[model samples]
Target: MFQKVLIWFLLSAFFLTAWPVSAYLPSDPLYSEQSYLAYINIPQAWDIAQGAGVTVAILDSGVDINHPDLKFNIWKNSKEISGDGLDNDDNGYIDDTSGWDFVDSDNDPSPVASPEYSQLSISHGTALAGLIGSVANNGLGLAGIAFNSKIMPLRILQSDGEGLVETLVEAINYAVKNGADIINLSLVGFEYNVALENAVRQANQSGVLIVAAAGNAESDQSAKDLNIEPAYPACYGNNSGDNLVVAVSSLAVSGQKSAFSNYGADCIDLSALGEDISSLAYYNPAQGLNNYYSYNWYGTSFSTAIVSGVAALAKSKNLSLDASDLTILLKSGAENIDALNPDFKGKLGTGRIDALKVLNSSLPATGKLIKLNQSSAVYYLDSEKIRHLFPNQNIFFSWYNGTWKDQTVEIVSQEKFDSFKIGQNVIIRPGTKLVKFQNSGRLYAVSFNGLLHNADSLTLTELYGDYDSRVVTIQNSFESDYTRGEKLSGLTYPDGSLIQYDNSDKIWYLEAGQKRELTDDSLVLNGFRSEYIIKNVNSDFYYNIGRPIKNLESNIFTYFLTK
Candidate 1:
């Protein structure tokens, strides 16, 4: 039945427009009630905010920008003139007053038939657009989740429902550059593209929220399948802070997972209504009568659009929300669907999105998008695998160029280097900023407040607490800035102190500059805090990378080795 409904969705992907080109307010609604808004409790949400002034970029087939319901809500590239056949804004697009169509490589992105037997071409985009932002309370067909948000139409897929990853990547880049606050992608592809992945990362860097479909499948898109090879862009990355992508699966009206909707804990972020959904539909009739029809749509695509609308509304209420804030905002406010999806469990994500709860929740807004310090960086284990997010972005290594490129966080030490040599798919991330001493040329870093203190030597067993303690690992060290990883016990260093290995008893020693008698019980080393940082690499790669150590020191850093 779900497949049958999905086929129904695809077959009518576009209702050929038979009505006047411009959409006008309708006298009657097709549904007995705006059940979705009532079902999703959007009225309560709207009491707080409508999606006013936010721009949602829709990268679908194309939209009926002239449709009466969407004409006013459609985004206009005010900088570029339309039909001039020129790239007026010098932004690589000419006359893209509305939006550009990548499939045809043209400026007029209105949906049209070309790929032969394809009803899934035009209407789908228009439907998605109306779902995101159709003029509301004007006696139109249906009120969208973010009825006041603006929709930027980027026609990446062809009329025949065919689109390439390359086109999608370009569309993402275009959306990021065009001042898009939120991007809605209702399509899906099987394979992952590196270029596309990087582009999505860049979008997050630019602070744009992304909403994508978990996809419709004949069978359940189980969490296992999704985690193994998740949907593209949607499953890009779901780490805390700086995450832009929110993957959504569909939930039936019964509050159960849709049989055809994909589900995954790692990728899928929210569950929304997908069954018997209603939105805009366009049809070009033989008689050329009224072409626009109020149609009830189904599938995850529509649900994805609905979620995007909710995000827009949230942003509308809280204007200071960055991409990361919006991402966390939607998730934190989600109504967990775990009890209903007991068989699927966390795969459905933080459950269905709650507009009212999200609006009422005390999630704070953020002005800064990119992190600026190592203390603000974070790491987590997804699928039992380590992932990282940092102020400087991900870890990077450059041998001669001295330019840092995006690199994954993998910790390694000099002792562990021989087993898995560098350049063998190794990504180096330092525990802290490693600063080079002015004269020694050696790089060292500290994780704590770097309070200058006289050295008080303690035992490896006493100083570290436990040898097998998990905090002893680099992963724990990075998270707590070596504060959790190390135990001064009662030892306090007024100056910045560090744990140095003695190599004799296989024990660790505390070294700050305190000239104490080197005893088996306690030992002290002589070194100033700002002189240098300690590093193992001696190559000519010009290894200079560090953040200010507050008022204690400037331009200090640390590095960790990992493959």
Candidate 2:
């Protein structure tokens, strides 16, 4: 039973998916600066790069191209004319003027009603797109992360928020071939598909970076841990020391690990703003694309978009920066948040992403990056004014999150800046215990996000004269697809809405009101062939649907199948 969380994070039983649309929902007119934008110093980055001249492909439940804030930033394939009935771009897809929609097998990639969410709730693509590259300074809705980057909307997941292994593979190839510099995958599942590995490899070869969510399930799926499952594509690492994908975790505005975020000492790259985020959402009846800055949009999926936008911004500053360069800049430049999470020292990826640090680094910097002595980081001077040395720098740490970045200050004995000398550990932030240094011969364990291997250590003169690993990523998201998914004990009704089971009371009742005993014995959470189903009674029809949908609930059924 693989449980999937929505990128938008609505967190309802029947709606294992995310995102919404209400005409009466309040809109933020002057969405000047989100708390996260200020936290990450995005305003400073805006002066350097807004991801101009870059193509960021959103492989999700299609983008609302008609959104007032997103229309200008949408990538228009000049080679193809809409509805011309011709393969205008000569790219296999016929008349793909804006982008291709793999689910509906059509050229239109507009946001649609997901069957899983009561046949009215829209998927997450539009909101995620707003975060990545919605139009800026247009005097409309909220400003996007990469305000000027061209957005290529590719719909691979079904509207119900599920995707197939084959569909994902084709989407990766499509994004790569269609000139996507970065791809955001906020969705995740426990299943491991070999085709995904191959697709990621191909994307890597094409110099396309895939930023994936570390997943919303709070399982501690670390690299060394054997009890839990690792998020796919995000955990897809090759032995060649080349990572084309970056796994991202979610963070609250308080700069602490979100309660819903998945953490691993070695399974994640870095975290970004995912809690109570504000962006643009799609409303039904075309209410001119309502802004969603007030309603909290939560998920690692949103964080993935943030990272992808940052990558695009980095690419803007230096076009030569590839996936590897993007990776390094993000990991190293992130604000060291290990101080915020003492219990999760090296496990919460590198740290929270900081736009100022990333852009200030002058990414694509040509030099052998320095490595921090994970066990022996110092403040360059001791309390008694002495130079310190720890020979066991290499033995103290292991590879987990992408990089371990510790800020170095010119050593001064008296300060509150969280500086340290040899054999010193302190409380840097609330609930965070950072071990700045340890003794020479102690068998200390360290975890890093980068791939661990043979190290030919080189000393550099950056950050307290400490040599650390060459930290790397720059940014991922996915939709909710729980149909064909197993019956978890505390799970919702299978494709049946308005009705739910109370495990505690052992009764089924209307979710809109109270619980009652089921009068119908056969009214079990009937997988695909629910009382709400009509067309397909056999298992074959359900399995081939790509994602699960309630055919009987409403006339609109969302299923992804390669045409």
lDDT tens readout by residue for model 2, 333-430: 88878889886787667799998799888433122111232323432223222233222332122101122342211211122122222322211111
Sum up the clashes in candidate 1. Answer: 52
CA deviation > 4 Å runs, candidate 1: 1-32, 115-117, 219-224, 239-244, 283-290, 364-563
428 Cα displacement, candidate 2 (Å)? 48
**lDDT for 396 (candidate 2):** 20
In angstroms, what RMSD does candidate 1 have relative to the true structure?
13.1
TM-score of every candidate: 0.64, 0.59
lDDT, model 2 = 0.57
Global lDDT of each candidate: 0.60, 0.57
- Top candidate when judged by TM-score against the true structure: 1
- In the order shown, the candidates' Cα RMSDs to the true structure are 13.1, 27.4
Ten contiguous residues minimizing lDDT sum, candidate 2? 473-482
